[model samples]
Target: MSASTRSPKLRVATYNIRKSIGTDRRRRPERVLAVLRELDADVVAVQEVDRRFGDRSTALPPEVIAEETGYMPVRFGIRPESLGWHGNMLLVRRDTEVMSTQRIELPALEPRGAVLADLRVGGTAVRVIGMHLGLLGLWRKRQARAVLMCLEALEDPLPTVMMGDLNEWVMDGGCLKLFARHHHVAAPGPSFHSRRPMAALDRIITSLDLRVEAAGVHLSPKSRVASDHLPVWADIVPAGPTAAAERHHVAQSPLI
Candidate 1:
């Protein structure tokens, strides 16, 4: 099969919903859901879906999200009331099959967490790491190293993606350097401080098995006010059997 005649494309996105609170200081779950509907991503890694205080319950209940967006949380009730662990959540389209889900603990100055989900996207196994790293640069670097170690321990190295609010300002150096060495850090443009939009805090890093065809920040009337960060999306095609064969063939060919 030719590159143009492959399976349907998959869209993955990451967003920090700010606990469903808009920049206007209104906690409206409906508005956040509206923006999500517009994004229409197949796999979504969300941060700040839960409140900071009290029981850390979900701002938008799982049931409400299911009914409104047809997106099911990868693993519901990580805590009795919380939809995710340490404000990191994963949502997949109803069609995607979940192979496994696990919570990752990191060395952090503050309470921070990451979620790893093994999913089947159009029959292709894909691994997703959703995380919100610490604030300080050094802490962020340590957190990134922890995440890399976790990925290394996986039994099967599937087409993996790591994404979410990394909170790192410098692009070339800082926390991204280690991960960028092995993974493709997507530059989806500036997505933070949704109103003015100056920094690219939210990011997606992928392994070589997946090819990013298109990527950008999703901005709109609802997104502008939905949260402090804008959602970032990427359209990717898995290196399936046909694509893999094509790659092998190219590598073996010596003559021009």
Candidate 2:
């Protein structure tokens, strides 16, 4: 395909917003939105969007996210009123078409879960999973294995992206090794402890079918103080002819 006809780059991000609480220990959803606007990702996997106890209602409610950043939160959680389960949330650009969504029940020492959203980006089907793994080394490995098992059970083999705070402070080894065997585990630089950032705990792993063009941590004045963990983003291009055709179709469609 010609350069002009090629599909535009798709930006994906994963952020552990710490429930919109900043380093100063203040809950500020507006600050979170400001950081997100600066990231400007097409799809974002967010962790800690809701409270851990009680009704589990949203900290950054869906309506607010929609109104502020023009992003639609993928609906999936045990609690109907909650934005996400285990504090994991996924958001897509308003233009994205969400085909289906579900929750992945993982066996862990603690209450751990994941959210999956099958979406159409430029009309190309892509499955995205947002999760927060367990803390223990053994549980973390089990959680990662369970996630891989869930992917293997899918009927169709579509391009998939797995993202969230893995909680793996050590970047080289640990549970991530299992994913590295099959997928491209992205290291978007250090994103943990938003104050003195040193660990690459947050990650964006992609299937072999997708092409990763760029990946990095979003460090800005607003992002630095928005939460305890910085946001990470990736620029990707869907592979194969279908992605190209769909992109052309989307581009040709009239603007609203």
Top candidate on lDDT is: 1
Residue pairs with backbone atoms closer than 3 Å in model 2 (clashes):
none
User: Listing every candidate in turn, what is its Cα RMSD in Å to the true structure after a full C-alpha superposition?
Assistant: 5.5, 7.7
Clashes of 1: 0
lDDT (tens digit, per residue) of candidate 1 on 7-67:
6677899999999999999999999999899998888999998899998899989899988
Quick one: best TM-score, which candidate? 1
lDDT of each: 0.86, 0.84
Clashing pairs in 1: none
Decoy 2 TM-score against native? 0.89
Tell me the TM-score of model 1. Answer: 0.90
Error of 1 at 36 (Å): 0.6
